[model samples]
Target chain A: MTHEAKTVSEQTRERLLDAAREAFSQHGFQGATVREICRRAEANVAAVNYHFGNKDGLLAEALNFAPLKAMQLANAKADGNPEVRLRLFIRDFMLMLLDETNGSLPCRIMARELADPTPALDKIVREAIAPLHDFLGKLLREIAGGKTGEAELRRCMHSILGQCLYYRHSHPVLQRLHPKLRYDHKKIETIAEHIADFSLAGIGYISGKTCA
Target chain B: MTHEAKTVSEQTRERLLDAAREAFSQHGFQGATVREICRRAEANVAAVNYHFGNKDGLLAEALNFAPLKAMQLANAKADGNPEVRLRLFIRDFMLMLLDETNGSLPCRIMARELADPTPALDKIVREAIAPLHDFLGKLLREIAGGKTGEAELRRCMHSILGQCLYYRHSHPVLQRLHPKLRYDHKKIETIAEHIADFSLAGIGYISGKTCA
Candidate 1:
């Protein structure tokens, strides 16, 4: 009976989170009301407050889910070699990014939060993303033999991400620029592989510093 | 005196644009009202409507200015070789992105628009980016002997822009990951270089033929 109660609670929590992600992604944090999330979840108004304490808490709860899932996937791709692990990390991240929606409202909401990140952003970073960063950093450090400057490694990693994420974020502009290729599956596939190849060139340069 | 009148009109237009850019960067399209923009510009609401029509029109106008200007700058560096022109474009784009922000609010807003473009996004792309595309496409065709697939080139170019833009967009997330490097100038510089180097490698893969 105790186990049944726990399972029910878990299911409720998951439902709330899914609803919150959709709500926050569409309306953004400031615009997304707790009442709306409750309505979407078909739960009580106080339920979100009970489960997450506030809108910010709910947003954090939803946002943290992806990073945690992504990190787990990324970490599992860790081969014996740090370089290989880092490469896998990049690939996994790109794939995760591609799996996102057309408008990428979730990532956009997250981007907005970063600009004026509330305290909630910190919690997500601490709990979900920090582990991924550490994993990537350690892998990069091993590849660099601790010789690459921290700033350089951060820049290289961020560039790799930026390249991968560009298509999702700038779909609107790219759509206009290349109208014929907006939803072309072949185009997206080419972009993914192309970005991966280029990012490797830049990241490998940083690792090469160990020899220099 | 005709030239003098043109100068004054240009100056006012520039001021309105500057104000729009500032407001849009800080508050985003949804959050920023025309009153705020007018107040920031020290111009009247009527002035905004006269120059750019509705709020959406104003946003389109604001988005149009930078990329067009950027293309002009990049085209100046064009040396008949598409590869060289592309490298120049990436380098110039990165420099402009770096110069345009401090804490990256602009980067955040731009990233959001890319992720989830709307009607306003259309004007920016159609009026502004279309020319840039034509210019780039012709250059690429020249290099590829008019043989590369349209989708392949689009992906490569998008990847280049993404690498440049992502570094600033994710700066805050990165800061939290490496707490000690928050807002570090050296870090931004390093990212610019990394993006340039990496994207160059990706663009370098343009052998002109549709392959794999």
Candidate 2:
């Protein structure tokens, strides 16, 4: 295709992905309708089929697009102490979840997918999540004195990530239990600091080092 | 009014609740049909309306019933050292999630509700989850030497509970990450011990107590 044709096709693909992400996050995969997605994207009825082949294909692309973009942003600036790096990773993660313009669409979609997985999960794990997992694993190993077993490392990693992700995926339950807990930046910073301190302490304790 | 009539009514209600809980857990509130529930319960169509007023009422009751029963089971034999008690709490919570016969219905339903809450959430939190939260908070406080401030206590509690809950709500993701991590009794015990040790160390660290 010509350059102008390629640009138009790329723009339409982006629009479709944006619309599909919003729809899937709000209504979940099975509940989201292709017609509504097309309407929101202002694309032709056949656009999803032509560009992405189907709704599932569109969903896979959408889910991958949002988190990969956020992960790229979070992985930027890789020069700091492990603690500072951990803090920045968490702060960026929280910002991605609580972004006003997007409003946690990536997180919401991920949680939904985790709850009831689809064909997209395999690609998500390989492309979007596995690298992040490896990155966090390395940071955790360094924080734990660099000598823990793989199983031990995984458990520790889960402890840290579980804390961060719990706040996002379980927001409704947390709010129900604690009505005053806010989800704004200030609260997220506090949460990040607490998680970092708690995790560092846990790591220190596990690694036989003094935390404070 | 009549003694036999009361027994019969109770039996029917029990049957309806069991059937509705299974249906709702599998298909969610909107996707589950009253007809399917009635068919499973072996009850007439009017029986649900008669016993529970409507589908929503039946669902609320069903949701309440499952968790309350599990909570009661978990709360049994609560006399032990705080650490022992915490281990039991985590173990029982895992058991409830991995219950083979019921297959995590309570968890699935609860997750669905948290993802897209309805009016039932208010009652579920107040009636089912609040007591458990209070129970866990007390256990954590005792483990932390009973001197941490409320906010600190809450963050600690979230850390522990988040760890336990992550294994449940994110099982698919975890399984995808580590195909060898089983969810049987032995594996659950190891997880419980790890969480208890990790949490006690974290609490001690937070409270300025030397954990090791």
Candidate 3:
């Protein structure tokens, strides 16, 4: 309850989250076990129960940190022309997605959950992800030029996010097909720019045309 | 066998595929059961085993239909301009995603499968998916002036495909957030245009700039 206790508890929770990010991303939720998470965290198995209560709860809590923090950063860096700001946001978002501190597990797990969502999905959307959705939709609306519809906008963001995340999520298989595509700074930036430009151009045309 | 017998067998197999598509798409591979598929198809459980060998086999066969057939239709009408043909391909691909004959279940199943790809992935990729991927990647290459790196071209194709498919795959969540968004024909076409333009511009810019 005291400030010191809160800080200590928070650090412990952060460690658990760090471990969850790695485990869930690698093995997936159903495949990830609590014992393994505890081992990675170097904390008591009861610590997870004590901190977040269950595996699903921990997973949900863990996913919240990176995207939420990134969305905050993306919104904060709103600058230049509408197009420029949107580009920066896309860049930041892709960078956030690759936050190895959190890893690509959140994306993999969140995506899997979307296909066959569980109850924890409500918490993820409500707490961690909805703000990013709102932020993007609002940005799209401002730049939309009155030509965009809600569905088109959603699809637009979905497209951008999907393209951004696909390389990392599919890295294993992509490398299987070709050995050269490494996940590093230059490649990530190239892909990020492509997605933003492609997405924004689509938005520009859609907004100009009045149907998207 | 006689031609008539082969035709009848094909129809029976089609009926089984319809059932598997719905079941697998709705419940995912592990989540879906053979009994439920038979119940839906109005065929005996024995028919499923007889037709596809098992649940996994049924899923693979089911995924092979619809999209490939529709993609063939798109490719058949391919034109001198790969970009223009690509625009059409994106349109048909969206329609395939909306293949109401199977409902949204196939979308869900495929999304989940991609999230946690199974042993079934290679077959799904080889029989049903690789051609489309290869086709799209080649279009990107032509658009990129055919000078892009192999890994870069593959990544580019992956990005475009991810964006297009992610719209349908993530529709449920996006719809809830925007309540205003709908996946109707007009809207789908609009988003497709946006994706095509966005991707085209990005590919052009990166290929030109990076290659130069």
Question: Which candidate tops TM-score?
Answer: 2
Best by lDDT: 2
lDDT of 3 at B55: 74
- The candidate 1 chain B region of ten consecutive residues with least summed lDDT is B100-109
- How high is each candidate's TM-score? 0.75, 0.81, 0.78
lDDT of candidate 2 over A1-212, digit per residue (tens): 66445687799999998899898877778778899999999999999999999988888778654564556455655665777787777777766665555455766687666655678887767766677788888877766765666777788888887787777666777787878966777877777878777887777666663223
Candidate 1 per-residue C-alpha lDDT over B89-205 given as tens digits, one digit per residue, 9 for 90 to 100: 655555555554443333345555655555666655655456655665666555545456675666555666666667556657766766686434554455555665655544555
Cα lDDT, all candidates: 0.63, 0.74, 0.69
| Model 3, position B131: C-alpha lDDT score | 66
Query: Which residue runs of candidate 2 sit more than 4 Å off their true CA positions?
Result: A1-13, A35-39, A42-51, A65-77, A101-104, A177-181, A209-212, B1-16, B30-54, B65-81, B101-104, B145-147, B209-212
Instruction: Kindly report the docking quality category of candidate 1.
Output: acceptable
| Pairs of residues at least 3 apart in sequence or in different chains that clash in candidate 3 | A25-A105, A147-A210, A149-A212, A151-B181, A198-B198, B25-B105
Considering chain A alone, report the TM-score of candidate 3 relative to the true chain A. 0.79
Q: Write the per-residue lDDT of candidate 1 for residues A117-182, one digit (tens) a residue.
A: 566787767765576566666766676567678867766666666666565566557656556754
Error of 1 at A140 (Å): 2.9
